[model samples]
Target: MVDRDRDKAAESRRILERISREADTGGASLVSRATKRARNHVSATDADQDDWIEQWGTRIGRVLGLAICVGLLVWLVMFLLRGA
Candidate 1:
């Protein structure tokens, strides 16, 4: 029973480690793919097209994030000015 418990713990630790690595590496891959897409203006192949779409999506996300941040800042300023 003790050996079985140790084996289970070891397996769980490995699974957790794998998940951590994937999460850390996945973001880099996405960023690199997006950068590659940005560099290629003309995508003659399907993969290029896919990367372009991903980059476009990332660009739009950045824009939206900026807009939200600006809006929040404006709202905070107004609230402070109003003494709310």
Candidate 2:
């Protein structure tokens, strides 16, 4: 019974060692694959982001300016009407 227990323990250790080695190799492969994919991907650059922000900012500024002009005109008309 003691020998059987020892044999079982040895077998468990061998299995664990093989599993650990396999896991390590698998993890390394995963990292390498991810790195390769990142290198190949053409993602957004800083210039692209800056251009996008500037484009939106210009558009928003124009809209806001138009709104302000319209609002001022409305207010001026109301004031004149009230005074009259």
Candidate 3:
């Protein structure tokens, strides 16, 4: 019985090792393919695109900030008016 148990454990270990190696290989292949696709999608003039994206991001941020401030002011005024 002890020998049988030891054999079973050894078999399990071997199977687990095989699975680990397969997963590692598959993950590496997936990562390589994804990296290649990403590199191909990006162009040489990405700097120009990045600048425009940054400008738009700043504008959107400012607008959202102003909106939040206005909303808070309106809420405060309404609360004060309700108590008055």
Candidate 4:
């Protein structure tokens, strides 16, 4: 009876381990695929004529971001000079 119980427990443990490994692999694969797809979409160079609006929008957004960074830097410099 003891031997039977030990064998059953061992089998259950093995099954659980296999399931855990499979779940880990599946989850990782899903995330990897999603990331790769997003990267590809972002890096794709093929542009449609209708994408002009999007292109302009991206450029404007980048310029705004740069302006914000420059403004922050200027503010920091002014603050430092005032403190000094």
Candidate 5:
């Protein structure tokens, strides 16, 4: 009974290992590749690097986006309160 349990465990491990090996060889899917491309496009460079222009541009863009969103929220609240 103990040997049978051990054999079953070993077989399970072998099957999982083979599955992992095959998945690694299969490569990334289309959605993953597209997501990776989009991520790369959004960021100018890695955090460790020193690319001042791109970094500052990204910061400014984020600030502008926040300001626009806030303005829209204020307008929405005013519109709702006024009941027009």
Candidate 6:
């Protein structure tokens, strides 16, 4: 019975080692494939700055427009309250 238990433990260890090796190989392959794909991908470096500038300009315009609208509303309210 003791020998049987020892054999079972040894078998389990062997199976675990094999699984570990297989996982290592598969993980390496996946990483290499992902790296290769990333290397082949064309990142948009040229348009990054242009996109940022355009977005910033749009935001500034929106803020300015909002400020003007709020100012006009406030002025109109004050004028109406002043009875002309």
Local accuracy of candidate 3 as per-residue lDDT tens digits, 1-84: 999999999999999999988677554677798877554434323334558876566556666776799999999999999997
**CA lDDT of each candidate?**
0.73, 0.71, 0.72, 0.74, 0.77, 0.72
Model 4, span 2-84: residue lDDT tens: 99999999999999999988677554677798888655444432335469877666656666776799999999999999987
Q: Residue by residue across 1-84, what tens digits does model 1's lDDT show?
A: 999999999999999999998678555678787778654532323233557777666666666776799999999999999987
Off by over 4 Å in 5: 1-48
Highest TM-score model number: 5
TM-score of each: 0.41, 0.39, 0.40, 0.41, 0.44, 0.41
The Cα error of candidate 2 at residue 52, in Å, is 1.1
> What's the lDDT of the predicted structure labeled candidate 5?
0.77
Deviating ranges (above 4 Å) for candidate 2: 1-50
For this target, which candidate reaches the highest lDDT against the unseen true structure?
A: 5
lDDT of 3 at 68: 95
RMSD (Cα, Å) of model 5: 12.0
Clash totals in order: 0, 0, 0, 0, 0, 0
lDDT of 5 by residue, 1-84 (tens): 999999999999999999999778358897997888656544634433477877868766766776799999999999999999
Clashing pairs in 1: none
Q: What TM-score would you give candidate 3 relative to the actual structure?
A: 0.40
Model 1 residue 21 lDDT score: 83
For candidate 2, the TM-score is 0.39
Which 10 successive residues of model 1 have the least lDDT summed? 39-48
Give all candidate RMSDs, comma-separated. Answer: 7.9, 18.6, 13.6, 9.3, 12.0, 17.5
